[model samples]
Target chain A: MLFRRIYQFLIVYCIGLTCLLAIKKILVLSDYVIPGIPLILDTFGQVFRGYFFDVLNTLSVTILGQIISIIMAFAVGILGRKSSWAGSFVKVMAYNIQAYPIVALAPIIFILLGDGFISRLLIASMICYFPLLLSVLGIMASPVKDIEHFYIATGRMRWQLEVKIRAFENLSKLTTVIAGSATLAMAGTIVAEFIAANAGIGYSIRIALYQSDLARILAALFMIGIVISVYQGILETLGAQLKTKWSAPKEGELL
Target chain B: MHLECDGLKYTYPGAKAAVIDNLCFTMTAPGFNAVFGPSGVGKTSLAKLLVSRGNRQESCISTFDIDTILYSYNQERLPNWSSIGSHLNKICPIGKETLKKELIEIFKLKPLLAARFSQLSMGQQNRVNLIRYLLQEFDLLILDESLANVDEALRETIILAIKTLFPGKMFLYISHNLMEVAKFCREILILGESTKQRKNFMVRGRDYTQGYTLDKKAFDATMLEIMNAF
Candidate 1:
């Protein structure tokens, strides 16, 4: 699975590069407008090591932001699982918060927290939180009626057991959602850096954009694509393993 | 245990006519009773109302002296992530270990205990579902075609085992199978073709347990009576 993801990404990157070169040839564009193969390679040779570290820095914030979003999503999902007034209120409040554009909110966040790690982290989490919250809420709110009826009949339907049953029934769906959310987390972190942060690959891309350095921007895109692909691949592999271990427990691990 | 229904009436929401209209029955002892009817005759709806302690102001389906009335059906599914053995262990009360073991053996579910619910066949799944309910603490259990998918021979074995093991408790066995109900249940209530008929009647069954098997003639007679009533 990991190898497939990497090769698939490589195919897309090659096609995209081919398109840009074609466009540059047709328009007779200069190296600054659409860098040639030699110029892009030169830029990669000059800044590959620095961009690698910068991408790693962005990745750290992405991981932390994803963790925060997952925790927040689960908390809200559980709270809003039922149809009670409080559950509905929590759900409505989450929707309202998600409706506000993060880009518009980023300036205020930077003003309060400044262009540092905390602001980047908060922005990334906010950008990644809403979609995940919606998915969790959807899974949690729907009851697995077939399994739940037995518990209800026996008078053993506690809140914790109810939550576990729902979660266990939808483990595969939840795993897929979590793995898919990695892309959003990476995008969130990069967007944060692009807007205001002073560090990470996004900052490098901003500087490249200002200098009209297409080669540098292309190099940064390459780094971001490679790292995000590897990270998402790892997450998907882990999700598959978890599903296997959960569905087919060992002999003594029955309960 | 005594189950008495006086002026039992139920109509589903957004329906044109009542499913169960002015129905009534009385069972005075703890035994394997049944409600036998054709398809779409509101057997499941009646079971739900019985378990829910139906609207007292509209109808009185009273379970006098019975605390917990559990309704188990053929379509009920167990949690699939865990094995059948784990489900039984989780649901079995503290003092019912011996009973659980016996039920597992009787239902012939020991070999399949290590398997997940989704891995089992329909018959096996129903057996496992019934076993978990049997392990629970309930005064009255309504088996609404709970063994529908099982073969005739195994269903007989399970029914006999349940009757033998839980002697003093009450079981309301609902099924479309006439022979089993006539042979096993002490009293069988047969519902009419439609609610408009208002022709529900009760017939005494042979009440066969593990050791007692009535003559073939008497069994056939009771079966005919139940069929004719319906």
Candidate 2:
């Protein structure tokens, strides 16, 4: 369980470290005449400071967007379960949304919501919505014949069945789904910022590219990695804790 | 309380013929009954109809007399024994503690309560499933092949426990095992093809013998004769 929790962080760390090393090698080989090592250190310090704030802005947007998306998905999921037609419609819409590429949709969202934080949030939420919605719906629909029978026999209301039984039964699966969607949420935020945003890691990278500042661009990339790694680490830790608390005890363990 | 279904007809969607055609039967309280049939004889369909008045998707052609019937089948949707117990408590809040303790002891479910449904052996799951429904109060309890996976000794113990603990409740024990059915159930409702080419028939307990215990070999022979004649 501990290994599973840290595996994603390890992967992100390796990727970030590799990118930083590549950037360092590039700085060493660059034709630009740096008179002393102090000059190079000063340049690196400035890039790191800028990357930190830009990545923080991006992280804030992604986290807020994901929370909104999860809540919306849950609302729709509950409504769908209550009504078969609504459920089918939501499923079809989710499928279409998932299939539609985020890159293609970002510009349209930017125009509609305007090139602001709202547009970035919208894009991130859209990217995160489908997976969370599908996971909730799938868990609800998965056949638990005995539990269904119990619900029907007891004359439980639709909402009670959804909230009390289905939700509790699928808590572990839902946690995993939310944690898994963190990366996609980050991706969506970055894409939104890249297309039209005034401040974010993606925006910083864009400015760095315009100015031909490879070191600053590298810093932005590495910071993006750090932000995602932190978000995933928190999610994974929460998921593990939930599993330990709510999961059925092992087979041999006495009740 | 009693369970009665009349003029029941069920045909699966997109099927050519009816699976259960014009089936009718009645089971009264204070009696254990067996629904005996061969494989693919719509015993399960009859059990579903008897318990829940047909699943949500199927059109309801049958008329049911009873409102609350506790049903258990071999295919479990239980996550774990603990949840199952908790659900039973939630459903039947009255006498929850006593019933849970009684059922746990009778079914020997204490050790298996913490294990997930999938982690337990099939026999363990079957016992757990039976105990889950037995916890609830209903006018009629339908056991649809619920004990098929259990061993002979455990099956006898469960049947005895049900008879001893829940004497007032009506039980419809559906199984292909005629001997086990004859052992516990005084009434037998055999669903088979009729002489007039009808797909279903209902036979009463008195037709064989109006008694709880039966001669095992003789009962098997009689059941075979009835099946062959059908």
Chain A: TM-score in each candidate? 0.95, 0.80
- CAPRI band for model 1: medium
Per-residue lDDT over A1-255 for candidate 1, one digit per residue giving the tens place of the 0 to 100 score: 788888899999999999999999999998879999999999999999999999999999999999999999999899999999998998898888878887678889988988989988998888888989988998999999888999987788998988888988898888888878888888888888999999999999999999989899999999998998899889889988877777865654433
- Best candidate according to TM-score: 1
In the range B112-196, model 2's lDDT, one tens digit per residue, is: 6546665667777888777767766676788888887788877877787788777777788888776677556766777775334
Model 1, backbone clash pairs (residues 3+ apart or across chains), number: 0
Q: Tell me the deviation in Å of residue B207 in model 1.
A: 1.6
- The TM-score, computed over Cα atoms with residue i paired to residue i, of candidate 2 is 0.78
Question: Which parts of model 1 have CA positions greater than 4 angstroms off?
Answer: A249-255, B54-57, B195-199
- How much is the lDDT of residue B149 in candidate 1? 87
Return the DockQ of model 2: 0.32
Error of 1 at B221 (Å): 2.3
i-RMS of candidate 2: 3.9
